[model samples]
Structures are given as structure tokens and as C-alpha cells.
Target: MVTGDLLMAARAGDGESFRALVEPHRRELHVHCYRMLGSVQDAEDMVQETLMAAWRGFDGYAGRASVRSWLYRIATNRCLNALRDGARRPRAGATFGVTPPPPTRLVEPNSLQPYPDSLLDGVPDIAPGPEARVERREAISLAFVTATQSLPPRQRAVLVLRDVLGFRAAEVAEMLDTTEESVTSALKRARSRMPRERPARARGTEELALAAAFADAMERGDVPAMVALLTDDAWLTMPPAPQEYQGRQVIGEFMRVVAFRDGARRYRLIATSANGQPAFAAYGFDRGDPVGHPRGVLVLTIEGDRISVITRFENSAMSCFGLPGTLEGSDHRDGV
Candidate 1:
């Protein structure tokens, strides 16, 4: 059935029709909520709220516009509501009273369900068309998303709707209930205040090649070469664990001495994306035997041709990334 017909059923209190109408958009909306609210925990909460609000108010949804657009109206409002309630904690690095300890390798990764890229499988590719500007992907990286943590909530909402998701000015105006001019000005300010990006220094599928090279380097435990693949100021941070390490000196030392410093570890990629940028689950293990099993799931972020960040997440993000328990030297020759 068409979306409009489904909405009519949903409005008539048919929960299954409403579920069918909303299911396709769930993962993307979750990603949208995640972009709007930096904390994964908070994003999950807001999505739940968005769904509940949508279901309870289905009867009031006017059919003048697409159901998708109306749902966004509800979701963005839910996020804005959460923001206005003042529930988020500010970044601890510069703005807070006590800087928390950095994330350790022993930490557990967030328990959030991984969204399959297959969401884009059947839907039209609304993400930056491959032909779009390069910065489009850069703007979606975790570092960029983390940097956006500093924006005022409303500005953050507008930017995500307009830039990240590729919503038009008029559509965003309807979503936010603001003038298109106001949205434009806010986006301008957002771009201005966003993290300063170095021109993407590396070229020619740098991220993919870098991921492969970095996997090789880590497998060989050649800290120097792995360090070479990293940007000078490269970092590794795992979400749900607030510890962020900066600079090659500190991060390289940690990777060399603590994480991969001693073991002959192997790796593989479960292809994935994080914070809207290129990502993978790099599974690690001590030996070629399938027994000692899958170890760490690492997420990489590339900048200019160098890997600017690598979050070696703890736990089943490895499986979530579709990687197998790896031997220190092999990935079962399964291609990503």
C-alpha cells in the first residue's frame, strides 16, 4: 500500500500498518537522532520518544505532505525537546570541572544495535550522491560529530537536517518550524564554528587503502609503520567510554606498549560506517587458530590519506562489524 493509505490505517488504530510505515525509516532516523544528540544513549531514548509520539498522534498527521516528512517533523521535535530539557553533559576536556580519565582498552563498547548499511539498499541513496563534494563525507566523521557536540542544540538540529541528511532549506523550515532564511543563517554559523578541517591531504581512496594497510601493519605489530599511517595528531576514542587520547606521541605509545605492543595479532574488516564516515570492524586475535577467537573491533577514521583516529572498541562490535574471530595473521581470505 502507498504511505498515505498506510497512514490512514495507522490513524484507524492499526498498529501493524503504523509499524510497517515506520520500520523502513527506523535505522536512518536513529542515525539522524544520533547526529542530533551526540550521546548514543540519548539518541536511543529520543528515537523511542519519537516513535511513541508518532503513534499517539497518527490521527493528527495531515496528508498534505509525505508521511516521511511528517515523521521527521515528529522526530526532530522530539530531539529538540530533549535538548531543551538540558539533560546533556558538556564535553569534559575544556568546559567541565574535572576531566575524566581516558578510555581504556578494557572497556566495553556501547551495547547499541548496529544499523546495517543495507538500509540504503532499497531506499534511494539520499546520502551525498557519490558525485557530490568531498567534504560531504568529511563532515560526517566521528571527530566532526564530536566537534558538533559544541553547538547549541537547535543549530545542531538544523545543520544535521540540512547538511548531513541533505534536506532542502524549505523542507528543514517545515521540520523546524522556522523560516528558510533563519535556517540558512544558522547553517552558516554552524559551518563557521565547526571544527577546522585540514584540506583532505591524502588522495585516491585513501581511507580504504589506509584501512587495508593499517590492518596489515597492526597484524605485523610494526608500531612504527602503523604510526606512519596515522596523522601526526591522530587519536583513538571509544564512545560510551569518554577517554580520548590525542597526538601521535601518546596514542602511538599506547598502541605499541599496551594494546598491540606485545602480541602477534591478526585482523579483518567487517565493512561498516560510523558517525556517517567510512568505518570497519577490524577483528583481532592472537593466533591463526579459530579457537582463541575474535578479539577487538577497531573503528577507523581517515583524514587526508592518513588515519586520523582508530577506536579499538571492546566486545561484539567485532561480530557486529561482521568480522570473524581472527588469527594474528589471517582473515579467512573473506573479502569485505
Candidate 2:
């Protein structure tokens, strides 16, 4: 059951044991890749690359480092090289099942494209056990990921390895090919640059209750109640579509025209978190059976008592969010 045994078995040509050695780390490694690449599909691909490299280069191992550390080492370097390669740009093909209705008239002064649940929420919530889940959830929200996205590559790696995953500075330094002193300095800077957490905290578990109410209102096409939940001058956006809408009426109208609000019911949410924001996978059902993860992702920006903005990720990049044609098939489903 030990990783060393699996590695030894793998070296002796037991591919299944080698895969078993690395399976537990795969999801978390994708998370690490997401942090480094900032694209879900890219992260998934990077994880695959890292694993394949590990397999092919098994002979190079001198057992100089722990297996966990060694895998991270491969992943971190792969992601860094991905960033340097420039051939990969963040794609916009992401889609959302739920989108904020756009305005027919003049739009609000401020707006941002809403990333879908699959895209914004694709973070793999890979806590090792029940005891660690809550702590892990708090650390992987959208706000946190957004902040990390701004960090320099090395510092980003340091913060993730040190603070998020609980690695010591020595371990982090070894992973990044640097000294512990440098790792310490990077963490300090990363912490300082982190954004001030917003005043409107995600309702956490209360999201299920809130989602139920919202679903009923949406099914009946109750514009007023839906508007009531949103902030004044709320912004709505869908990515890869390149359209923006602001304010309550415009948002309402867009919803009517675009969303298939005809006789919908039995809406179920996948119950996830993103960017530290509360979110859901948002499955749809007419009578009972599920139809889609169409609103592939939702990231809400709250400003006290009201939902200030909502972004619907449109699966812009074909590969980045790990989305195939539909959620039933491929898109990486986690953290949202």
C-alpha cells in the first residue's frame, strides 16, 4: 500500500501498482496545476504530463526526495515551463447554465465577465479526509485563487506549498529549487499582496437554502423576487459570449429571452465552492430527471444583504476548463 512499494513494483514493470502509487495525488496535483496554469484544462493536461514524465523517468530516481515532493517537483516545473511557453493563452469557450439577463438599454459603468461554475469553480476540493475538508474549503475559494493568479510563479508555488498544503519552508524550497530563506521571503510578500476579504461573506452552507428559494422564483420566472436577492445596479455577464448587462430590468429581460424558463422544476445544485465564494453545479430538471449543467458555473459577488454581481462561465477555452461537449462527459467538476 505504500508509495515506495508501488514505485518498486512499477520499476519491476507493474504499471497498475505505479498508477496506484500516484492515483491519490492526482486530484490535488490538478489543483496545483490550476494554481500554476490558471486554466482548468491546462492544469489537467499538465497533471497528465507530470505523471507520464514520472513514469518514463523512473530510472532517474535516486530516492533523494519523498514521492509526494517528487511529484510536486515535476508538476511545478511543468507548469512553470507552460507559463514560459507562451503558446498557451487562456481560452474563453467556457459556458454557463445560468446567466444574468442583459440590459436592453444603457449598461452599468462597471461589469466583469462571469466565469462558469465549471471554469471558476473547477478547483478540485481534494481534502484527504473528513477532518480536513472544512479547512481545505476555506482555502480554495475564488477570491483566494484570483489572488494567487497575480503572484509571480515562484512565489505562487511557495505560498501554495507552504501555506495551503502545509509544507514546511525546507520542503517548499526543495520543491522550487531555492533556499528556505528565499521561500520565507516569497510567502511574506504573497501574504501582503493578498486582497482584503470582502465585507459580504459567502453564506457557506446556507447556500443550499438560498438556492432552493432562488430556484422556485426562477422556475416561476419571478423577476421581482430574483431582483430582490440582487444588489442595486447588479452586474451580469457570460464569458466567451462577449455580452454584458447591468441593472435589474435589463437583467430580467435577458433572462426571459435567453434562458429556457419554460416549466422548469426539481433544480438541484452540485453543492460546491469557488474562489472562496459559495456556488453550485446547478442541474436542471423539468419533472424530475436532470437535464443539464448548463449554467456550468456561477460566481457571485455580494455586497451585504444582496447579490451584487453574477458571472456565468461560457466554457470559452475548449481545453482549459476541462469541458467536453457537456458536464456529463468531461468538464472538471469541483470547487464550484
Candidate 3:
């Protein structure tokens, strides 16, 4: 077969043929590792390890399974090993100089990072085809990814492979080096932990309208108008800092004391999308600078017409989100 010939050529030290065989699956595999590890940098490292292992073990590849499946097997095992070693979990709050409030019952994924839409250019939009049961967008949402972090490592892998990626039970078992019965058992527990449906969030024109109104209020320091757009139980969190503010009263206090206390700081918000949600790249001006420097990235979780959660990440991560380090001119706004 053509693929067998290519594999043979690749093993014979033909670098071009090897790349031709593996290049197509690179992005998808990276996304898979991101879901497992919850960090983009970790995912990138895992992908390199997977490919290197494949290249070194080429002789053991009997061509019984497709190259894609083989690569996934390698990657999955690598991630599992990393998890077992505790080498990749989020650091403690004290390490970041954060004093976390009493632990709430709600599960929060630590060290959560945003996935840029630009990196998703060539990735296929996963939909419920005859083979796949879950929509691609739901699988990649920030909420969903955070929820998976609560599950045990094996259960997480089973749920993602079975439901998100649409891999059959037998296929998943083979990948994990387990029996189908074990895979089914793990999947049952995983599904029970997952919500019956993805959480409802504003979409399309409604989402655009909300984001615009929210940005406008922040720019003008309109506290009441900003408060009007939040759900009663809205939550605000800035990761790497364990502080979380919930409920309208507490959030308003946060806005008044921390954000708008010194008066409105000049900001420019450029629209972007992350984790299948609307996000903005925020740029703040120094006293007399003509242009603004990156402040942070804000990702919103909307429930119905009101925003439910605001997840803000540090400005140091702006580069990964495909945002420029500086914005020029007095006014820079991009309509969503």
C-alpha cells in the first residue's frame, strides 16, 4: 500500500517522507495534549516527545494500525506518565503570592490558560458526524476543560477519547493498553461526572452586543451599566492569583475599589475568541504614552443575556493569544 511504502521510506531515514506522514495530525494532537495537561507549553513539549519516540521506535511500528493512532498512543502514554510524576500540575497559591479564600465547593482549575483561535486555523471543526457524538466547540470550551481537571487521570482520558474525539471503545482500550470492559467502566464514571449538557452561554449577535456594552462601560468607568450586564451569581477570577469574587455586591466592590478607584484608566480592547468564548486583548496607557501596552486578556462566560464569569489572564500571555505587545494611536477599538 502507499502508506506502507511511505512508512518504509520514513524509517529508512527519509526526513521528508517522515514529515509527510505526520504533519497533518500535528495540530489536532497538540490540542489533545492541551486538553490533557491544561497548559499550552506542556502540550508543545509533549508533542515533540511523541514524535521523537515515534521516530526512534519506527521499527516496532508494524503498520497494523494507522500512523495517527500510533502517534496518539505515544502521546497519551507520555501525558499519563507526566501526570503520574506530578510534574505538570498547577503550582500552589502561595508560590504566586496569593492568599486564597476558604475553599468553596465549586471546582476551579488552577493555572488555566487560553487557547487562541489563530492556532485553530487548520483544525477541523468537530461536529456530531455519524462517528462523533459531541460537538467540537463544546469539547474545547474553557468550562469543559476545567471540569475535566477534576476527574482522575484515567477517567479524563477515557471521557475525552470516547466522547470528544469519537474514538470507539475498542480503539481507546488499545490506545490505553487496557481491556474494553475497563474502558467502558471508566467512561461510565466519567460521563456521570460531566453535565448532561454544556452550560448555556450567549451566542451570535447577543454575545457581540454584550461584549460591546461591557467594554464601553469599562472604558467610561460606568459602574452601574457594567453591573447591569452581570448575572446575580456572576463570578470574577484572575488566574495565577487565587482571588475569586462572586455575587453582584462583592463584584461591584471589587470594581469600585480595585478597578475604578483611581478613576478610569485609558484602555483599548481588541476583540478576540478563546476556548470557544468571546475574549478581548486589553491594552492600558501609561501617563503620557501615545500607545498602550498589553494589560491582560479577558474571557467571558455568558449565561443567557448576562455575563456569568469573567476569566482574566496575565499580560505576559498576550503573545500566545496572537496579540501585539503595543497598540498605537489614541483610540483603538475593533467591533466584534
Compare the candidates by TM-score and give the number of the best one: 3
Instruction: Kindly give the stretch of ten consecutive residues in candidate 3 with the minimal lDDT sum.
Output: 95-104
Instruction: Please write out the lDDT profile of model 3 over residues 188-210, one tens digit for every residue.
Output: 99889987865677789999899
Candidate 2, residues 223-306: lDDT per residue as tens digits? 677677876698776543456678887777666555545344333334444555544445444444433444555566655656
- State which candidate has the highest lDDT: 3
Deviation of model 3 at 257, angstroms: 1.8
CA lDDT of each prediction against the hidden true structure: 0.64, 0.61, 0.79
Superposed Cα deviation of residue 45, candidate 2 (Å): 0.8
Cα displacement (Å) at residue 103, model 1: 11
Pairs that collide in candidate 1 are 102-243, 103-243, 201-304, 202-304, 266-328, 294-325
State the number of backbone clashes in model 2.
Answer: 32
TM-score attained by model 2: 0.67
TM-score of each: 0.70, 0.67, 0.89
Scored against the true structure, residue 185 in model 1 reaches a CA lDDT of: 93
Residue 176 of model 2, lDDT score = 80
Candidate 1 shows a clash count of 6
